[model samples]
Target: MACYRVVLIPVDENWTPASPDDVPPQPPQPNERLLETEDFFSAVREAIQFNQQTWSERKGRWAVVCEVGCPGKTWPGLRICTPLRYKIASIWWPPGWEPNSPLDMPLCICRTHGTLQEDQLSYEQALATIQALNQQAMDRASTMWYVMLAVENEPVSRTISYDPAGLQTTVEIRRLHVAQPAGGGHGDCSHCPARSLDCSMVAPA
Candidate 1:
């Protein structure tokens, strides 16, 4: 089962009600909740392994693991396998691809369905669900493209990097570009292809 603990550090400035010492108590700072239970680690490990196997079978390639975190951050105390330690990986996939293709495979359990509540599913159950979803996708597709697997303490701090060989497994990751469609009717001049068509199309005098 997954267990999490949120630590609160008092911030002097933000704490209301001045203390007897004539100083305001600080607001509580949030610390990363540590995963302390052995069962929790086991579940996480199982999930990772299940995801890895699912990706490999569906994509025909193993996911790549990447090291993350600052030098001194306490090892979140997860009890996963050694090889998977400190290495967050991903299964890359192309966009708009067929099912079973790497492109259509689910990246991770956490990603497929947002982070779990404090203690929703045991790590094993989460992994199992992820594997089941991935297999379902693979069973439907003939050739998949790419999939990415990543691990990080917080989603914001997570980043995608290339391997030592300077080779990238994913064509593009975490980067998005969008273009507006052309205007069809009048008045939307900014997107009009033809410059002659002004706001009021009543032929210029």
Candidate 2:
């Protein structure tokens, strides 16, 4: 099962990055309104809504964590700055899910960066391509290629560093098991190309 947590980052008006290339403030001001949930996607959905409504006018951003044992339960998590497309493809698909179509994907919004418009266009174009690909006849081997293409096309985060002394409250971090799609045409990955590759043979990244 995937575990998630939402932390509200307090805004700093006087604090600005020393350089344009500098990274965001580590761990972000003190995290408030810590919320935990077992459902990863649902947590993200709530974060988006929270940002749209409350965080829009506020100075800081709300971050969602996959909770993989990072210090203070930060870093290795989804911050407000992370692109929504990357969040969906990277976080959602590994749990043995297959979208019926592009429409199944969730809409992502980032009020802090004012990226809602750009992300909307990118989201539409990406889904449109995926839809077109779905119409084509694909050999089993090519199925994984479809997934890889979609993932590689999206933007990646510059870094994954959060404050080492992150969360103050007690938090449990655990490994995320990538579930396998059941066989006999019952599971989401029944048609996935991941089946062709042997997990044991693949080296860990």
- Per-model C-alpha RMSD: 23.9, 13.7
Task: Indicate the worst ten consecutive residues by lDDT in candidate 2.
Answer: 177-186
| Candidate 1, poorest ten consecutive residues by summed lDDT | 175-184
Each prediction's whole-model lDDT (CA): 0.27, 0.35
Model 1 per-residue lDDT tens digits across residues 82-170: 12212112333323323422123321112222222223232234344444544554576523222222222322133456899997653
Q: Candidate 2, which segments miss by more than 4 Å at Cα?
A: 12-27, 54-61, 66-68, 72-125, 137-205
Evaluate model 2: give its lDDT. 0.35
Highest lDDT against the true fold, candidate? 2
Q: What would the per-residue lDDT of candidate 2 be over residues 50-163, giving only the tens digit for each residue?
A: 655543455555443333333332344342322233111222233343544423321111112111122322334544544444334122312221211111111222334446
Native-vs-model 1 lDDT? Answer: 0.27
Candidate 1, superposed: residue stretches over 4 Å from native: 1-69, 73-95, 101-113, 116-126, 135-205
| lDDT accuracy of residue 200 in candidate 2 | 26
**CA error at residue 140 for candidate 2, angstroms:** 14
Question: What TM-score against the true fold does each predicted structure earn?
Answer: 0.20, 0.39
